[model samples]
Target chain A: MSNLKGWKEIPIGGVIDKPATSRLYKTGEWRVSRPVIDREVCINCMQCWLYCPDMSIEGSIEGKRMKLGEFKMEYCKGCGVCAAVCPVNAIVMKPESEFIDE
Target chain B: MPVKLTVTGAHAVAQAMRQINPDVVAAYPITPQTPVVEYYATFVADGMVDTILVPVESEHSAMSAVVGAAAAGARTMTATAANGLALMIEIVYIAASYRLPIIMPLVNRALSGPLNIHCDHSDAMLARDSGWIQFFTENHQEAYDFTIIATKLAEKENVLLPAMVNLDGFITSHGVESFEMLDDEVVKEFVGTWNPKYSLLDTENPVTFGPVDLFDYYFEHHRQQEEAMNNAYEELPKVFEEFAKISGRKYDFLDLYKTDDADYIMVVMNSTASTAKYVVDELREEGKKVGLIKPQVFTPFPKKEFQKALNGRKGVVILDRAMSFGKEAPLYSLIKSALYEVPSRPKLGSYIYGLGGRNTSPKMIRQAFEDAFNDNLVADEQRYLGLRE
Candidate 1:
């Protein structure tokens, strides 16, 4: 947010000074429920990664096997699309306030 | 040597474009404006100009393509009329809001309901609040001259706003007239290369072009646009001064004809002013104290200049080529607002004339002046000239 300037300092077209400030805003606060992934049962189908509206899911290939990477909590609005699209039920939508990190 | 040519307003604009040799021209055709782009397209085909001519499917795409090209740091232009302008109006506002200095030669035509393809100011009037600087031209000479002038004004460093050079459809656009053409080298020197402060292609200075400006910053951006508009009003005379040096033709916010000591004056714009000038001359020979005021620049309204021109006149008649429906005509209401703070103002009368290309002869214009004079210098109500009922 420090990158943001007062209205007077902004250019004529309301151009942003920095590129892609979405990384700085933690949109997770906007969510009432959050998705928790169960890696053990996850088939690595990459369906959740493709279905996430906020593009919070990441996928990678490891030794000829596909695997899910870290979830970007800063941008995840906790939309249940990722959890609902999981064919193997490897993801669950837990209440945001009740979920505690290990 | 300066060349002379007898050509239509559309061809004159094409000749100007050829001399300017813009970076891109993206346009789709509409009636009365097709010849403008058509002529330029031939130049492009013959390798006369190094412009990228984008023949888009629709006016929306035309404007969209130009917006993209202009954001990418290219000097751009386009032409449209009537329904074509209406179709591209959504992007027209975006072009101004983005501060892209695109020059559009807008041929004025009536907005359709009965679907008439004729000359009127309705199309240009509809885009009055769209933030583009508008210059209304009287004839083919002005149509050619203002296009070059508009390019310089739009590209001013402190006043980077889009501009429209408006000429009446069919009347000026199709009518051929003889005018002196500036030397190609002189035109190139007059309108120098466009220098953009920030462009989409500026990788080292990576800045966003258009961003999602919310409630927090949207108002401020608008304030900046307003400031730029004010700057345009100030910067216009300086450009006209420079242009006059080479061209030897003087220009101002409005053209005044024998209004200095006249008692009755008619305020109008575009081709009708030429007809009214004859009426003024005939009335003057009859010893009637009548004059004429023709405004060239429509946007930035030039309130103070108009007030000064209209000062001390006994009766002033304003003619509108387009109607405003439930209220007073557009120019009439605007003139009233311009004179709002003046301590003394001339008695104001308005008439809606030339709707859907109805003929406004010298006789009808003479009657407008006569009506104003016979009304005892009191503006009773608005009237329509040449209306059957």
Candidate 2:
């Protein structure tokens, strides 16, 4: 009755449609990969890079700024040697169940 | 009092166990060792020994029962053979680690797998690192003597480690011979009732006996076990001195048989040493300077005593009944390790024989001496003296 939709602040150039925001914005697609990196607690320790039997480490020894060596995902048998030799428990392998295409 | 009768080594062990009157005995009857348990069972059935003899399913269960009974503050005992010992390996480590003071009679036999039932050092060699004090007897008398000594050695409060008295399978376990059995009153006075401030079944004091130890403290527990083993060197003399007073049969780690004024020695263990001593006597009659250094106590191996015995000897030939697959025989390695740093060391030669109960005649043992002396002094073949196959 009293123009309830326009009661809030109205723009001068008619109705401007706003976009919806999502919590999962800008996150990478977690496909079937060998080494999964956690951005929060990753101190960039390269121990996994040193003793990796499959050489399955990715990203640089420094901060997560640049891409360094990538893993040959086909050859990784998931021996957990990288996890064992890790200084900080940052890089963890996602279980095969989590990567199943739903 | 002396019992001059031809009895098997099993009977000898059973008689000693009967006289000692253990509170609990749990044993499994494996071949060459069945006679011991059977004889003891007869004693138990006849009401000779005031004890509970538990008939176990396997050597593993037998050792487990002894450990529990010993933990419950009972004088416990058991016997086993080659494969039986192998099965009880894990619990053997546990029993010694817990310091249960359990005594085990091992009828030394060949470990199987070419399907052999005979005498060999396979069992004793396998258990060299299991933290038990091992004694090897060369004859019926020493076999009887060791059973009594083992009880006294294990029950000492400061040296509460498990002990094993090893007797050769058919040679000692089945062979019949006359020997002296100590008086029951003397043995009773010798092995008094076990009294411990801390025990597993002592309900008055609830304390954890075997707990899960983490790495930080597990090493310390093992170190303590090692300390107890090393403490046996000094404690054994006192225990033996006391035993001497009671039984009047004195013994030492290194039994020097006709070694005085001899320039050469054949070092050995177990029943074969008895035969070698005979050969030494024959050689001495032929004006040879050869003698026998038989180690009565194989574990806590008497390094100083052996060193003194081999001080000025020209050659020291070791006769081993056991064989190491990839390396030298265990006794050979231990002897070499013991004598490596000593000044004026003798020429060392190792001979492997009596495997799977292969007969070792005096002629074969004498051949070992000749082969050792002739084959470039430091021999390495580890020649098998007598074998059917």
Candidate 3:
């Protein structure tokens, strides 16, 4: 919270100076839920990566996504779209409080 | 040499638009404002200016097209009235939020229910909080000048925001008055060309506009928009001064006529101010010190200027062409807030008149002044000038 820029420091007109800077804005701080992946049950079908609106699902880009990958927690907005799209029930939405570090 | 032409307020605005020759004009016509787009489209059709005139389906599309066009780094403009302005107002906020300097000429008319096409300011008042610089013109001449000035002001580096140049519905929009139009070359050079700091077309330095800004940053962006209004209030005079150099018509936040030594000052807006000034003359002939303060710039509200202008007066009467429904009239409420911190404030009275083009005759104006100087004014004396019981 202390590090966030004040009104005077931000650019005028809500115009993001460079495209794709949304990656820099962390949305996980107050997100109510987060997606949890069960690696044992996960089939690397890559549906979550393709369906993620925030593009928070991260994995290898060799066209196969053969192994499970880490979540880009900073950009994830806790929408269950990625979880809902998983072909196997490997990804699930959980209360962010369960994983939040004190 | 200035061209001498007798033209309606709408045509005068079009003549200025033709001179501005903005990159794009997307407009859907409404009465009183129809002639403005009609004339500008003809200019575009005739190759008078290299402008793309997009005849849109509705006022909503009209504003949407201009917003998209302006965002694409094109100098853009549009015109609408009353319900048309109402239709476009949602995108109008977006236009300001993105800080696109689109110039819109608003033909003031009453918002509907008892739908009638005539002069009143309820239309413009609807946009008071929409984050655009607002200029109210008293007649056709001002309609012409402000259209050109708005182009320069809206795109002024410090104030990159949309602006509305307002003319009373049919009274000013359809009123034909001869005004000296600036030579085309002079105006072209005066406004110069738009060199924006950020543009949608600047592919080299790619930028994003109208992003899904959330709480973490939305406040900062909206705060920036809010502060731009202050930047505009400060930059307006310099822009007006520059226009004055080109057109020889000096402008300020308030156009004060015989106000300095008056015991009572009357504040009015749009064409109604002309009537107020005439009554002031009639009263002055018999040695009553009444004067007129017409706000050339209405959106910024010119709070400090109003505080200074109304400080030492014995009394002040505000005439409004629209009502606030639940409050004292619009102009009256603004003047009240402006006077809050003044060291010596005048007694204030509000006289709402001419809603939906009801006639505000000299007789109605006289009644306010006749009562103003009697030293019986309250802090908030709300009265109807010409409404018959």
Q: Write the per-residue lDDT of candidate 1 for residues B1-389, one digit (tens) a residue.
A: 78889999999999999998999999999998999999999999999999999999999999999989988899999999999999999999999999999999999899997898899999999999999999999998999999999999999988999999999999999999998899999999999988887888888777787877765567878888898899999999999999899899989999999988898899889999999999999999999999999999999899999888887677899999988888888898999888878777889988889999999999889988997778644454888788898
- C-alpha root-mean-square deviation, each candidate: 6.7, 17.6, 4.3
Q: Quality of candidate 2's docking, in CAPRI categories? A: incorrect
Q: Please state the CAPRI-style docking class of candidate 3.
A: medium
Model 2 stretches astray by more than 4 angstroms: A1-102, B379-381, B387-389
Q: Is candidate 1 or candidate 3 better by lDDT?
A: 1
The candidates' DockQ values read 0.33, 0.01, 0.63
- Candidate 1 regions off by >4 Å? A1-7, A23-102, B376-380
The full ranking of all candidates by TM-score, starting with the best, is 3, 1, 2
Best by TM-score: 3
TM-score of 1: 0.84
Model 2: lDDT equals: 0.78
Candidate that scores best on lDDT? 1
- A1-98: candidate 2 lDDT, tens digit per residue: 12223312321111122223222122222234456656566555566777876555555644544443665454566666776766778668767566
